[model samples]
Target chain A: MHTDVVHNEQSMTPHPAGSARHPQAGGRSPRRMTPARRREHLINTALRLYSQQSLEDVSIDDIVTTADVSRALFYRYFTNIRDVHVAALSTVVDELIGRLTLPPDGDFRQQLHHTLAEFVTFVETYATSYTALLRSGSTIATSTTDTLVDRVRDHVVDLFRERLGHSSSSPMLERTLRGWIAVVETTLLSWLQHTDLPREQLETWLTDQLLAMITTTAQHDPTAAEQIRHLLAESGDEP
Target chain B: MHTDVVHNEQSMTPHPAGSARHPQAGGRSPRRMTPARRREHLINTALRLYSQQSLEDVSIDDIVTTADVSRALFYRYFTNIRDVHVAALSTVVDELIGRLTLPPDGDFRQQLHHTLAEFVTFVETYATSYTALLRSGSTIATSTTDTLVDRVRDHVVDLFRERLGHSSSSPMLERTLRGWIAVVETTLLSWLQHTDLPREQLETWLTDQLLAMITTTAQHDPTAAEQIRHLLAESGDEP
Candidate 1:
């Protein structure tokens, strides 16, 4: 039992999934699971693998082997590796979108900070996968994967519009929001790579960047200026 | 010759490379030049083809046909289509980097506006190729292509540092500048796709976005604050 504990120490550690020596070894009972459960298990395994390594390096064989299942069982659920990848990525996207919420009770800046912190958390949880998905020119990137990423951006745009009590977005508002989203992404990507700045500072800096962008846009675009005025009034803050 | 004029009318248009029905026909003579000139002619043809269409669609046959050269001659210079693509992209990068000059005579804002306008012009000139190279998941994207893009970014960072009178960059300044560079890329890619905003507005907006970013960073980073203070003082502008 002591030897088993020593052997499993790597897996027992809560962080640094990359440090696991046998990430795909002996985690599940293959025959006990229903088909749906098995499929979920496979996807979870794939996502776990992706979070620890490059998405291009995670193969069907690795997924099955890690799940302690036969290759036949793996194909029974997903047609191919890319299918599994797409499915796993969709799961991640859904989780990210679902978890992002700007609480109603807080001031706008506080809400924005909390929402961005949530985003940073999600990014941290799936650092490798998020990087692989967003980094251009990855060999494994497909249209399906690209669409999943777009879905997140589109959802965030909608969320912001709804929060601001706007029925629809003007071109200036839309472009400014989308541009800020890109800034968030690029900043997070760089942050993930180097981790030079503290997370709290990065989060606050990102929040401030959006405010700055909106303030800048307001100077040129009357619609943006009016919307920002209303937004600031609602938050009881000065623009 | 008059009939030929009608046939060549598509190519004669001042803009819209995409409108040319035959982008790769009768542009150059085969076997008439020295080997060095012939190789350059082929690369130029490949770039022209890329400018007009998706890089993935431009093939070895297309290059040879456009240059009016034989397959044998094409093989002498390039091992494959991708080789020519890398070469063509390098030329574009070199031209863009070379042409980007922050002239010494203007206020900082004016100089920045002019430099950005030049960049936008380069983007317009190689719109298709630039999109193809930077768009994340083109099947034709290779490590060489990705590296070429990075070279442009790195050069821009160095350019900014030199302009700021900093021999080296602090972490805050580096990240802010790099983040702003990303905003430019993402904004340009979106603009290229939708083109709703006018070129003048886009240029001014991008220039302002960097200013806003620097101001925001100054609040959190002493190094950035000091640098921006110095920068603004030099330009007789407020931060």
Candidate 2:
């Protein structure tokens, strides 16, 4: 008995669910359920419950009851509560990623502002789930979430690459892209951790701050500076 | 027994020490361990044990035998095994924090590079334990970890204010500092997750990337731009 308790405590950390469980028998007539439907049901139910309590406070029983499913059914959909939470949160992250594409014609500043606003809007719309996932670090494993972030990083790098044009080689492009991604991720996470400041204010502030960093760095790197100016000219920005 | 098993599994997710049996008076002589010493012992033992297995795999029997302490003694020090893990992990985080002070007298790029290098060094030194803490979100309380992260953010903010000579009331200072910290944390977490890369290469890449971000961001804002220019001038860089 004692050993069981110890084992349970050790396994409790929320992890990304790698596999979807299939509905099982012995719960309310054993209606057949597909893995996709079961996963969706569990995630929606868990998201609703998590909004009301600490993610840690919600139990398997609460989730099963809320989903109107048996314990076996719950297990069929997710390995644990955290798995459901990740699935629910990934939906919102996916939406944000969809909205953050690079504008075909905008200058770097405009594109950056658009991306920043999209991110803030997503965070605002799903504040509770976003907060829960960020706080728990459970969102780290969701491939969709990672893909969204990576895509944004790639877009930013591409913008810098286009700006650089004929001024740099493969190495410079890699370095610039990597640096931009690191800065953007660090800044976003810090803001998420700190103030619950309203979305518009945060977005504006971040947009301006990011632009400032990009400009200053470019000025110091002669090659990067030439690229920025060329891109600015191409985009018809006032010198 | 069933109820015990449920309770054991639920609690075990956080506390492995719960599995230890309170020794009968004649079963084993209880060691006269101080509270602080016992906690240290438990944390050290758990770290060693946890590193060897998934956080879920280490049992109370594993901890008790390793620590040579009774179950009752373990409970006295921690509410559960998760508490012990958090306490242990907190020590490591605190050590990292202690080493994160910003250096005096350098250009914005140089200062930013130094601070980032410090972070990389800390992460490299505690890579295994750090990765474990990040992976096992189950054992650590979200609120507690957020509070710790907030402290680190404030420290970074203060450094920005001091170095940039910007008042706390300045919105640009707040935005720039907050954004930089966010980028740093996100980059570090991502790097931590990708363990295949060499630490030295990763650190160098991170440092160069962060400096670029800071430099770029500095140029967009008049006040920040001025600060960067002054910093560069002080460092004998020709405008």
Candidate 3:
């Protein structure tokens, strides 16, 4: 039905699994969806609820009702609200990672700008989902398995490792990378609250912040400093 | 009475307000001399509890019972557990701020070393309180007032300003500083999770991470960067 389409594309949050227009956006009759489609439909609906409320505050009924699916349909995919939350978060993280790609050719600063530009736009679009996810404190209830935040963090760590591909591993390097990620994260988190600041400015600041942490870390740990400098030399884009 | 002192000084977290060695460590004769002393006593007790639990998880009855203070006596200083939490957090924040004394005389990096060395030691002693307070997410519940984390953050911001005491204000500067604080905080939070890392190494990494962020920010925001460089020039400790 067009109602489901409109509901799905409600500008609050669109179900990622469904087609952009939902084919049913213009009509009022509900369409029959396969099991996979139903799961995506439920997730997109749950994401909307999550964007509006904290993870603990949303309900299974809220998700089912929003998706226009019956409780029986909802139960087919998820055993509890926690599973839905975890899946919804996974979708967001996947979407975030999928959208990002970094070019290895350019000044490190320029490379940073290219990556952050994409990230900022993403943040602009899903500011609500991003907020709720961080407010979840990088975790989910009822499960100790890796959450979306953990996966995102790993992706970042991997990206940094790839960038510095030749450098030998050390605790200092690990700590520095983790510290830089925290800076980038908190910087973006606070930036979402103050959108008055230009996205261009936020990008530049974040790029610079990461660079600064590296130099600062280098000051105290000579071996790390040397190893990082060597990596930068090999990269052909040393700052 | 001695059992109370033993319980309080169990070393998971001792009162930051008290000397590292509680003069009353040898034997406990619940010394109740004045209202000020009693408030400190209660806060110290609450901190030990909080180290083991979270801010929201602790209760007034838990605190009063632990301190062996009657409910009537507890009522004299605080109206709720929230107030006690805020006050106790302030005490820890004050102790943290007090130990740090950055001389305007050295290289900025060296000064950072001095400041962070003190911070790391403070963190080591009060790891639990530091974790709980930050896990409180830097804002107390049930009120919109400043939390201890806020005060500590402000202190770092102020310290950054004084270090670049002569630089003019810019949004870039502001963001960069906040970014550094986030790095410091998240770095410390994660460090607590992996305590086998030497304290000296942690301090070095944090200091380097902060310095790197400032430099990186300068690279992107040239005006602020130039102003910062000029300030360092004036400080006679340019690297």
Candidate 4:
């Protein structure tokens, strides 16, 4: 389950040349290109170029030419083309993560399903760029992935911690959250690699796995059984 | 958890060129370097150089100078420096996988702990090289990671399938294996990154997580429960 690959895809496209071309050359009454607008233009152009070819196949020259920006301006805004790609990816990830709503009051299974479904849809919709980003594996790309994983880990850990209350620090709860995140990342990556699996089927499969990790007593203390039950119920699970 | 990082460290180091370098610059009777020996030389030199500097910081000239190999020979052996690094990585991963011994008759908990400990130790030993290997998100690096992952996944899945006596096509069992692998990989990676935790402590934590995932019934059907029980029993756990 290599979610790293999914994150990787978003980080690797759009060679830095596009961003480098942003600043007006030989500034004679230079038209001011706002940073935000320049970024958008670069990303949109890069996406279009990335969709048509491999990341390695695309050069910085190609992106600058496509985006109609000066090399100096591009550098002014981005450290490199990879940075631009990562910035684009960060936007997508932020959007995707935002969409993953953990209802303050839904069954853990349902919540897991919703989250997985949303993630799968995002990856599928952006498959080409995603794959390109993953294949690139630049420092910026990896850092973006690390950021995503860290954010997701913190989110899931918080959810479990909230449910577990004071017992949140318990090793068992920590293990459970970590295990679920691991499975989720892996399942997402596998699905991305092999998109033949129906979204619902993948979601259902992941939901069951996550629910089992949360509810089972393999590593949980015997005393926490009731607590687990109460937490599950609060999350809308009957059992 | 980024066990990928650990694996990356073990394989990316290039051999020391000082020992391998030929004294004379002029081609005085070129020593016939076997493909295997040449690969070893390249890996060792690359790892050594990469350790001192970033991947981008290191050049092909640096590697060739250190390896005492002709540029043409280097090309013959690898598409680029990254290719050499990946090959080095694959070798280390294959070795680690080979060393993993799953006791046929230990308790489920014990077997898991034993395997997890072995894996952690392998990663810790090669931590530096793995860091170098995975630092960049190049296509070659990602592909190398995929190959390493596929190898580990195949080995673990086969081990579990044999224990469960499940057909290769069993969806439930397959998912179970994949989930377990995901959890393990994630935990290991986390452990690698978080130096605050002791290796033994981290391994124990990971073992507990893996046991919870395997012993739980999230992905398996009731019919498969018996097989799970058998697995536990074979591992010396009373089901």
How do the residues A57-91 of candidate 4 rate in per-residue lDDT, one tens digit apiece? Answer: 55678767765557877788788777766666666
lDDT of 3 at A85: 76
Q: Which ranges of candidate 2 are over 4 A from the true structure?
A: A1-94, A107-112, A127-129, A137-239, B1-33, B47-62, B102-115, B134-141, B162-169, B192-232, B235-239
Give the per-residue lDDT digits (tens) of candidate 3, residues B56-166: 677899877776667988899999877887787777777778777787677777788888888888876677667755552333532222345666777777777776665
Which residue pairs in candidate 1 collide? Answer: none
Task: Give candidate 4 regions above 4 Å deviation.
Answer: A1-38, A41-83, A131-140, A144-149, A152-172, A195-197, A215-230, A233-239, B1-87, B107-112, B131-142, B166-169, B193-208, B211-229, B232-239
Task: Report the TM-score of the second chain of model 1 against its true counterpart.
Answer: 0.86
Clashes of each: 0, 33, 10, 45
**What is the i-RMS of every prediction?**
1.3, 5.6, 5.3, 4.0
lDDT, each prediction: 0.77, 0.54, 0.65, 0.59
Error of model 3, residue B45, in angstroms: 2.0
lDDT of model 4, residue A124: 63
**Docking quality category of candidate 1 according to DockQ thresholds:** medium
**Over the stretch A1-239, how does candidate 3's per-residue lDDT look in tens digits?**
23333223233235432336444333342546556666777777776566566556678887766656678878889999878877877777788787666686886667667877887776666666666555423334222223556677777666666766544445667677776676677777888887657777777666655555565565666766766785555434353
For each candidate, report its DockQ versus the true two-chain complex: 0.55, 0.14, 0.32, 0.25
lDDT of 1 by residue, B1-239 (tens): 11221112222122225445444355535345566666767777787777778888899998777777689989999999888888888877887788787788876778788888888988988888888888777776767888898888888888788778888867787888888888888888889999988899989888888888888888889887887687666555466
**Which whole-number lDDT from 0 to 100 does residue A163 have in model 4?**
51
TM-score of 2: 0.58
